[model samples]
Target: MKPISFIWILSVWMSLDFIMHGASTDPFDFDQVIHFKIEIPDAGIEILRQSNFQRRWPDSSHRPKVKAEVRINDEPFKDVSVRLKGAAGSFRSIDSKPALTINLDSHIKDQQFEGYDKFYLNNSVQDRSYCNEIICRELFQRAGIPTPRATHATVELNGRDLGLYVMIEGFNKKWLKRHFDQIGGNLYDSGFLKDIHANLTVNVGKNPEDHSAKNNLIAAVYEKDLSKLLPGIMRHLDLDMFLTHVALDTLTWNWDGYAMKPNNYRLYHNLDTGKFQFIPHGMDQMFQNPQGSIYPRFRGVTVLSLMRLPAMQQQYFKRMLHLYGTVFKPKQLVNRVDQLAAVIEPELKKRSLREWDRNQRGIQRLKDSIGARGDFLGWELSAPERALKFPDAGFVSIRNWKTSRLRGDIQFRNANENNKQVLVIESGSGINIGRWYSQQLLTQGTYRFEARVRCENVVAAPNDLYGGVRVRASGSRINAVLTGTRNWTWVAADFLVSQPVEEVELSCEFRGMQGRTWFEEGSLRLVKLR
Candidate 1:
């Protein structure tokens, strides 16, 4: 009847950690491997501010100085020494000096993972976590990308063991903050934006008509022209090198890499030398999204999306193919896959068989219970193909709306008779037409609706003809409208049903009679909200 105590839990957890970190027969003992750490002095902050102030676009100021220590059996190795080297710059207000230098023995026993062990040691696969930015940065540099240099070390204390330390070059902050300010602070909403140290004055310009609360702040410090600084930054970047990194990122399922928001990229400018550069930093949560997801699909850059933007996407893709091709053979991707799988599989297998069996069994049981009821009802991937070819057919058919084309033929096929389709007619006299129909109805709930549409030589003003998927409950309705230029685009909207209705309706309304519009494939499926 006694309650569990915190110390008791800690003891049990430590016992498990011991088992996981036990010595292995393999030549390399991953358990004993001590990743590196870095520490930045307060003076280093000023140098980072001045150098990166304007150039570090989309990022915040404050680059912590990094240092790595080597460890064996949880003890620092005293005999080993360490030194840091890279691009030179002022550490305080003085002239530029070596990036960093420190004696490992001077701070051996003091180094530890600090507050991160809970997430890294407890929430990791195989009891391993690349919780260290030093390791991530090293991988980036070795991949031939323009990354800051990183160094490792070993240190020892009087009665303890050896440990590892890592050091990495810091980035400019002034440049990054400027960009964030220019973009209206929307960049902060992204998961990629981190380490927000200070706040800047909010500046809203004269024109309030075209700005939102978000844009005002960023536009205040926005640089109108970036081309002037692109050249110098490109010199160090090697577009090919950066693109190669992106490609490897995709192959590795490095979801974290692609998870960046548009604002995370920084643009550096050396005013004295008239040089400009683009730099990528912050890899703390790198290498996520190894495979695709089924739910609200993981948001990140993908080969598919990249390929869609033929011009810019093609250039980046070719660079990746070319660079990766030079270093690895055609079969190298397969080999790399095997190597990564070998590294991760053993740990995952053990967890699946021992630690996660209960959870896995519960998920499997739930899946079986749902059975055919869980099948997804929505638009097919091939709907685009059918839409492009037919050009005037409803991908999803709703009942009741009349289809009359002053220009093209439109067809509606109904899978169920109870859904309503309404069309709106707009004329110069402010007159509109509305149609109503009814059939069998399903219970009100959240549903996934999708439509593939194309506009052909359509001339319409913003208030003119617009087509969309609509959901209605009682007499109230919510519509997700698709209105833009005469091009194909996908639009989605989430709607909630607060009341019960006997039928569903799909309606298109025309604000004016003079405009023309076309509809292709459309579909909707009712789904239970979790």
Candidate 2:
């Protein structure tokens, strides 16, 4: 089999020639909407309907592709394979205009669509403004992160006019060549709410069985010692680039990205440097929570572990400041959104007046959020760091927790146990992640959190991601849990506060079905490590 290739140098020359000769032709143009018409046979449409009817997340084995004829801006491409694509938030049935993945060279070898072999047509349900993806991608690219290009499109499938969609460049061999100098590596997709610790499916690779690169990266992230954590991670990751990615994610308020959640991302193990690089995806929801924390609670294992070090924390903050000063321009972004709306809103109005109204309102909201985000980021970056107060004993007893019912029915109250006011959490009939959490402002340092707990009939929730009944601080790598019947034994987890001052959440959570757990009062304490 011949290795897939993209003529990078020739493409560069053509780009220069186009610029020099003032040619009005270029692919991946974001200034205008590209009209796409897809003609699939009845059998192909049925296959798509069946695929969309499943309504499950996109995976390798479940989604099947059917042949179709595609036309882009009046240009034709026959013998293409089209498959329905989306996760939980953006998925729609074929009748309701589903998202699609169009592969140009699947059946026809060496076929290209405007110098691209594959592309995505996103159903812009999550982003009513239809501008977040492009804006966020531009921000990431400006911040020196290798992100895929995105633009607006109006797609018509089988004569049924689907409304405006966000057309994104696909992560194929051409994309790899475009971004990297060397292209021999594995590309792993963060499939459907999965993290790096799970078995991530390889999207592009030479040998799927050889997963040493990914394993090494995970092992580095799992390093327990704070002293060795950054060095270990640096061995397997492009640390600076990764930190820049995190900074951009934070500035954009990408709540669903790799820095916040372990979803909507891609990891590429670069062969030239033997390091992993993160790529952001599913960014339609960026900037939604404009005032969300700059110091976000990281959920990804890699970021959580590296963030435990004070040096890494400082570097992260510095990167955020740099990117904010350089790449994040609120007025420019809002103007871009206006420009996009001007081009897309008319097309949208032609489709549905109701949709156009909704989109206009959404666009206004999006612009306001972008401006608010810029103000918030400026204030956060300019504020002076405050040092937290600690006693001479270097320890504090935790108290005054608020109850949070995450799922199902959970009862929380204070009770007398062994002559002490113990906090109790009782689970109802269904499974729950009942938590009694307290937040405290703390300075940068290492600390150990300990709580004496006793449990009764603590049946662990099936596939519980947080373990069983346990006392832990948010964003900590400590794994300590107590299940079933147990005496008043101390359960402890070590945590490191990396910021100058941060509000850390200490949680006594019971993640189980039908369990009663008691956390002995006056025993919950945080002791500074150094």
Give the candidate number with the greatest TM-score.
2
lDDT of 2 by residue, 460-480 (tens): 877876657988898898576
Q: Count the backbone clashes (under 3 Å) in each candidate.
A: 51, 0
Per-model lDDT: 0.33, 0.86
* Candidate 1 all-Cα RMSD: 18.6
Superposition TM-score, candidate 2 onto the true structure: 0.72
TM of each candidate vs. truth = 0.32, 0.72
Off by over 4 Å in 1: 1-142, 146-240, 245-259, 262-314, 323-530
Query: How does candidate 1 score on lDDT?
Result: 0.33
> What is the C-alpha lDDT profile of model 1 across 1-530, one tens digit per residue?
99999999998988886688553422122322333333333454344434422133434433333333434335443322223222112122212222333334334543322211101111121112213243344445556554543333322322232222233333322223433333222222121332111231222223323324333223322323434233322443234544565554443324344323322333333232222223444443333332232112223322223333334344643444454345423243333323433443343355355433442343233233222211211111112223211113322344333443332222323232234221222223222222222332433345433433333322333453343222333343455443333454444344443222223343333322233333332332223341
